[model samples]
Target: MITNEQITAYNEAAISVLNGSAKNAKSRVKVFRVSQLIAQETIMESVDGLHLPESSRETSAMILMNVCCNKVVRPIDGSCCQPPSAPALTQKLAAGFFGLSIAGCLILHLVHRHGHRRSRPCADVEAGEEKKAAPAASACPSEVVLQSCCKLGLIMAYFYLCDRADLFMKENKFYTHSSFFTPIIYILVLGVFYNENTKETKVLNREQTEEWKGWMQLVILIYHISGASTFLPVYMHIRVLVAAYLFQTGYGHFSYFWIKGDFGIHRVCQVLFRLNFLVVVLCIVMDRPYQFYYFVPLVTVWFLVIYITLALWPQITQKKANGSCFWHLGLLMKLASLLVCICFLAYSQGAFEKIFSLWPLSKCFEMNGNVYEWWFRWRLDRYVVFHGMLFAFIYLALQKRQVLSEGKGEPLLPNKMSNVLLFVSVVSFLTYSVWASSCKTKAECNELHPAVSVVQILAFILIRNIPGYARSVYSSFFAWFGKISLELFICQYHIWLAADTRGILVLIPGNPMLNITVSTFIFVCVAHEISRITNDLAQILIPKESAALWKRLACMAGFFSALLLLSSIRGEHRR
Candidate 1:
């Protein structure tokens, strides 16, 4: 019915509009294609000289595709694709890290030169006054600082490469179920390599404790690396291992205080620094929440609790308390008060949450908003540590009474008493197994943990006390591992496992065994280096002579000021 001229004009307008849209879409597609090309070229250049395996290259490409094409959904209109944005922050961080590494190298060079010049003067002075001569300084003001800086830079580089070039980043998925062969293999290896202690020692001697921790740590590492947290038995046993660590903490600190009877500022600072230095540094470098590294904070808090309880009570600090009964009563009273406090926290969830979520420390609880997280972690092994302290008290008291075997002498008790102890230990072990097997949920497990943990802890104590077992079962390998267990645990959060312990990175790709071996070797080396650095820092921070109150105040002020500055920078960067 319409005129021919009008219809032709309408058709021409429609064609022009479609042409405009097509042109825009074509330009967008061109931009995306160019960006993709550039990303591929950059990645290829980065790995060109490395001579990576074919599987590794393929994996690397897949990782890059994932990172670059992430969140780019298909358009219903079938329009142009948007290009991926570059990881600008990650690149900037890598640059800053390399710059710091260079600065550290320069500082090391200067320090070495200065040390050489000062050595002659120090030697001359020592020659003049042999009696008053100071000990020679170690080489170059502790290369620990340089080593730590370099390692940090390397870690940052790895992270940046994985993020920017998308080398090893992959979607995290639950691994398929596997047999218990891996864990069994781990146990058999540990047992086969076990070496008994040659000399006579106490039931829970330093070596034995270290060995226990070492074996537990090794098992835990396997569980994590193998992604076996889904397995209930492994998970439950890991919980027990963590509880053992807390037990050791309680026993170690209590024994030290009981023997030395000293809780000075210097001691507190030393312990805090040893536990927290690396963690704090990582928090700044990696932009992670303080609580991301929760174990250190947990131990630090426990240490504070112990210090406050002992330092406040004059009776506990008294070198020569009148009666053994009186000392025992005082100790029990303190522990009872602590138990009451813990109970109050457990019962009052709101109060507990409010306390942990308070300003400053709240930064740590950012990842998990609920106070239940903090409570669950605190309550799981709550009584286990106290059990350790109680055991230590009884052991020491028994030693004082001369009723127990002091060294390698006669049995502490008669044959009947020994038999009874053995029976009790067996019952305790069976009880723990039953309790573990019955747990239906994490909440239920946590609820029963404090009660059931006592059985296993006691069983281990009794077993260790058995004369025959004690003499023929020591593992130097475990003892060595135990010494650096803290480092291994902390360092594993980043390089060893990635994505906040959720996923594993593929370094060698196709060959799983080769990849694991390479990763583990590097991980161990890094952890050992960190251990050395921690020791060096301890020596530097904790002076033999007590620092003056004013000097200590000044140091704290400077430290907090630096931390504030770092926090501000991080906040700005985040924005």
Candidate 2:
């Protein structure tokens, strides 16, 4: 309606204002490229802080936390395999337990010392010359509980510090599987120099078994730390080491029952307590499921299976009153029955899965509501225990017939017999190694694993025991490590390794050598302490007297009932 010049001037001014606004918006946004990807982000500073509404002085912590705790939602690749992280609840519980355990240990120690000093003065006056029996440390429930808690606290602190705070962790510290042989060489060099046992080592005796367990555990630790499972030959051999452990379980338990002729439930309970007390505590502390520590579950199940097999009707024992050929035949029949059942179970993965998926067992074993992992683990080592029983049967039969003997100054027949046995073992060893290396996949390796893993186990035993001096003397260094191998196995999943054993733990951060050295020292020391606590707890839990056993069992049942109730509540909350 107005003049053309005036209208044009109005429109130009409006256009200039719009352009300035667009420029300001562009300035607020940042565009960047990383490698092949590009993204845009808006940058801004905090205008106001978070605060809890209507909080008093006592509740002021809520406000502080609200303001201080900033969360960054880092996008992780959902498809790639990674370790589970600590949850908020896990961190809180772990922190509390850490504090209580450490402080409780110190306070209890002071109280115990003070009480002992007070008792000494009275004892000097009351008993002029007679010495009173010292109180049994194992009998004290308070000390055992405190020590166990202390063990848990220390380990949790190390785990929390290393994993969450990244105290000793370094980025991009990937393990090189190609360097596997280097550790073997160094370990062998060290092994040769360790002082030998003075006692004449019997076949599979404590010293011998300990040394065997030590070297095997060492290999397993190396295998896990280096992520060498991808290397076929090494992976397959490590599988054999695992099989050997199960073999020990069968042989040791069977030998104990047959030779000692003690099939009492207390013996079984003691063994279970020793094996699982630390693991159960860890399950609670680490907030991991029982199935998370795969090895213990595997070993535990096998132990139970072996126990049931021997404890069934017609108990066979060479040391028992009914120790005759018929009883020995009964042992063979039981072993055969076990093997047949194992074969049937192994024949169908679905059937195995269905069996383990049953209500109560599923709660213990299933990961993400599936037993695929358990099935894979269970089936791979299914027949190994039977092999152990068979081996024990044959060995015991031979010993009973006086064809073989154990102890000092006794040669296992002529030196030629030993040499021939050693030569055959070497052949079997190389043959298995070659075949294992040729496998393209783990499935293929596991297919023949049940049958051929025994080859490696037997070969190692023959090679170890065939030599005259080697049979007589053992390495004390390896034996020492062997003593705590179980603890090491369970503890390594947390502090020694990281991310539930998918990564190695770093304690020094910079130099890999120094880091490994320091971490290994701390790891060994912690494991040793854990081993002591486990022993002390086991001693108290499995009492010698019948009345005390029932009392302990009642207490344990109540404890478990409470745990189950809490777990149920947690599940309901999640739902």
Candidate 3:
């Protein structure tokens, strides 16, 4: 039996496998044969632990390796080298940019302070009406206080810009297509900007990464401030913005994990559930500002399909042998089952809508006859749904190891239940497709197809259950886009607000193409820039006096409170 000391030695050596400083560790450990290594429990456990926590796993492994190497090797050779620190220029520039961004934030904060002072109640309506008067006066900060704060002053300027644009828009009265056209153009331009910056400007030391995280937190602050101070509508209130802010942060957190490559079923579930949180919140809080009803189907269909397909996918990872017909057939059947679920969903939804017609809830979500046409109204809208599905597939692939492992050692039955499920799914999809194809007119299709919605929901459940079927094509690309999706989603309105104020696209009245093209382009670039700046800021700012995760989140809440003032002001002004 291996002594405890020997086992400890073996565990350290195993960790050294990934550690950077273990250059000579291999030579030292080579004294022991492969048989000795295979017999080590610590080594096996270390390797097993590698698949946990998507972020920091690589670093953790490195640390483990380094520790092990120290124990086994006198002077580790061929170990990973520590990266040199950033050059002075990089550091200086980072600091300079960071300071400038903070200054911007400070200015905005000060302006907000001033806005509050001005809004303070005067001695009017004292004594008897004191209670009512206090509530009214305390309702919001005053305009005078706002003007005093320089940072808020810029926000106010933006608000005025929006106001001016709104006047122009109201006069021109853009139709649906025209509305999104400008924004699309701006988004493209932003993409180009990001592409130009893709070259590695500098490598971030661990310290720098931490600093950058702080910077990111601060940038979030700016948005939160603007949300509270700026003139957005009541519907676009601070509470809603905060929820979206959580989503943005969550996405960033998830991305950190994705890049690190440590994935499992639990992590996948977290991402799915977190993303769903935003979807649910938005559904409850926001009305489709425009005919942007497309986001509903766009976001819905992909998750629905992927969830269902994956939920029932026979465990391909479990099979120790090479791939076989059973795997392929099982996957196909799983997909089919999803389709069947979708069919049932569609039928059920239709039934509900028919029964609930004129019901208060149904009225709010009355669908058009040709739901597909509604979905296809903007080609881009369809892309959102397409991308959503793609993302689900991508997540599945990333967590393939865990999913496949789960299916291992199961009895090999014909999987008759899966087959039946698949049949139902296929029929549902076909039925819905037929209905879509046979629709007489777009107007007739305007009545939202309840059956179609059901189909989507069922599909989602099926995809979620499937295993090893999802192959994501564009991880990096989509990740980048997804990172800023919140910005694109929110800034669309701001860009529109700005352009309408400026009368820039007034000539192309009712042309959504122009609106989408220009506004999207500008919105994307601006949002991307803002994102970069904020990320940088998050690195600099810390929850000083050191705290826990929940406390950190609370700090964020405080930061958001400051930002909410900006949003409330903006919303109030807009209204």
Best by TM-score: 2
Candidate 1 residue lDDT tens string, 1-575: 55546756876676566565674555432222233344444555565643434555565565556446644752221122223245444335546766787688778878868976765533346467534345766655446556656665666555444322345633243544453356657665875587865365676777788888888888888777666677665577678888888888888888788767878887788888889877876665565666778788788888888778777756473354434577778888998888888889878888888898775666555454445666677877778777777777777767666677635644446778878998899987777777666767766776777777767776776776666556445788777788899988987776777656765655687787787788788878877777776787577546666555447658866965766565546566767
Q: What is the TM-score of candidate 3? A: 0.31
| Candidates sorted on TM-score, descending | 2, 1, 3
Q: lDDT of candidate 2?
A: 0.74
Question: On a 0 to 100 scale, what is the lDDT of residue 264 in model 1?
Answer: 80
The lDDT per prediction is: 0.68, 0.74, 0.38
Ten residues in a row with the worst lDDT in model 3?
196-205
Superposed on all Cα atoms, model 2 deviates from the true structure by an RMSD in Å of: 12.0
Could you tell which candidate, 1 or 2, scores higher by TM-score?
2
For residues 1-575, could you state the per-residue lDDT of candidate 2 as single tens digits?
55546856876676666565664566543221121111111112213322212323223443234334422332221111233355645446657876888899999889878988776733455557656757645536877777787866777677666644535442322457556778977876776679675465566778888888998898888887777876788888999999999999888888887788787878878988888887777766666677888888988898899888888887777776244777777788899899888999888888988889886687678886689988888888888888887888787777777676465655665678877888899999889888987889988888889988887888887787766566888777788889999999988876777756766776675587888888889889989987887787777778888888989889987976765556556666778
Candidate order by lDDT, highest to lowest? 2, 1, 3
C-alpha lDDT of residue 270 in model 1: 83
lDDT agreement of model 1 with the native:
0.68
Clashes per candidate (backbone, < 3 Å)? 0, 0, 144
Off-target runs (Cα >4 Å) in candidate 3 are 1-297, 308-322, 351-440, 443-490, 497-521, 530-575
Give the top-scoring candidate (lDDT): 2
